[model samples]
Target: MNKTPLNHWHREHGAKMIDFGGWEMPVSYEGILAEHHGVRQACGLFDICHMGEIEIKGAGAWEMIQSLTSNDVRRLADGQAQYSLLMNSDGYAIDDILVYRRSADHVLLCVNAANTEKDLAHLLAHARPDAQIIDLSADTALLALQGPASVDVLRRLGVELNSVPRFHTLDIAVAGVPVLFSRTGYTGEAGCELFFPAAHAVKVWELLLAAGADAHCRPIGLAARDTLRLEMGYVLYGHELSESITPLEAGLEWVIRWDAGDFLGKSHLQAQKQAGLGRQVVGLKLLEKGIPREGMNVVAADQPVGRVLSGTLSPMLQQGIATALIDRAVLSGASEFFVDIRGKMKKAQIIKPPFIQRG
Candidate 1:
């Protein structure tokens, strides 16, 4: 198993460790619920160095990127970032990714930790001979500072938070270390991701925690992170998405830009759109007190209609909420359904996503 640079630091801080995508990572520190509330109310810091960062540069980089990703690369200006997908020929997603437009000839792609190598191989296979691609994951460290108090905490670090727009990045220096700061986050909160050299990982993390101490900032772990993202209806790679599932079926049409011109899955996606969808992803709120789990049957009138993709007890809503990919016909005809939780049928209602929208 792999370990990040801060592995020892996490152990010293009494973080409960677990294997996540072949990397030993912290699942919780104080506890999952406490950490969840911390991020929502005050602030929380996360060690996200296990994620992958690949750099694509040189002439023809733009063309190479356009051919591989689903989003409109041409719309991204320098210092801007976009949420996109690395798609398969069948229009299914290989991995959902974030693209940062560093310059006209350079772009950075951040992928999930487990799909790093697969994404790299896929990009290289489709890239032109002259397009330069570099994997910077091993040499870099990433930290996510999130919450409602994130901007104020950054301000204390001497950053002008007002200057950095959402989805925009800043090339700045923090505590003598050069860093790439982006106003982005996985948690549905105002936050920033700090990328810097791996050697300074511990120093940078300690600096931020100390700087935000008075603001009630603390270290968070993956357990709360998962719950936090699920509450916002954010899609996880293996659960909400997979090689068999297309972004359109995953309720991620916002990231698909057909007018951006041809891409890897353009034809299949265009056809799917024109022909309408057979299945759709929707959010479900348990009307009763049962925590839904993945692979559980979703039934309507004593018949199974679909399966739950991802489910959890939302920390914010304090209710059992889930994202389920079900037959579109069932979604249209049935206003309510039952989740088969361990042989018992529990009442549930279909609703639009973002089960815990803040504003």
Candidate 2:
């Protein structure tokens, strides 16, 4: 199994380690619920070094990325990042990535750890002779300190939060080590994702912890990470997204840039846009007692109409909630459906995504 640079620190801090994809990662430090609430009320830090970072350089980088992703990365100025998708010929999503345009000739793609090999292979297959692709996942260490109080926590590190706008970044020297601070995060709260030298990982981690002491921040794990993203309706690679699913089917049509011009999956996505997919992904908020589990059946009029993709006992809502790929035929015509949880049926309503948003 693969391990990030901070693996030793995680084990020493009493983290519950588990195999996530091909990597041995931390599931929780103190506990999942405690870490979840900590990020909600104060702040918390996450070690996201497991994510892959790929560099696209050379003069053709702009044209190369434009031909690959659904988002309009070319329009972005230097240092701007956009959330996008890498697709296959059928328009199915390979992975949802963040494209950072460092310059006209230099672009950075941050992809999921599990899909690093697949995504790199797919991109390299189509890369032009002038374009150069570099994999720097092993050398990068990513840290995230997030919450309403994150600004104050980072201020102690000499980064002014108010001046750092969203989707923007700055180079800073923290604890005498060079680091790049990006005002972005998976959590729908004000936060920054920091990338620094792998050699300085221990020092930066310790500094952030000591600075956030008054803010009551602590180390968070993958369990809380999953739950927090679910509450915000953020799509997980294997759960809400997959190789067979398109952006339109997943309610992510906004990310598709058909007006920009032809790209890899242009024709297929445009055809689906014009004709429409038979199924749609929607959020399910359980009204009755029971937690919805993945692969559970969604029934309408005593017949299975769809299947749950992701579900959980929502800590904030105090009820079970889920996201599912429901039959568009029934979803558009009906208001609610029953989830078969442990052989018992529970009622839930169909709603638009983003069940919880940050304040």
Top model number, lDDT: 1
In model 2, residue pairs whose N, Cα or C atoms come closer than 3 Å (at least 3 residues apart or on different chains), thus clashing, are none
What tens digits encode model 1's per-residue C-alpha lDDT throughout 38-126?
Answer: 99999999999999999999888888988888899999999999999998788888999999999999989989999999999998888
How high is each candidate's TM-score? 0.98, 0.98
**For candidate 2, which ten residues in a row score worst on lDDT?**
350-359
Model 2: per-residue Cα lDDT over 33-143, one tens digit each: 899888888999999989988999999998989988898876788878888998888888899998888888998888999999999999889989989999988888889
Q: What's model 2's overall lDDT?
A: 0.87
| Clash-forming residue pairs, model 1 | none
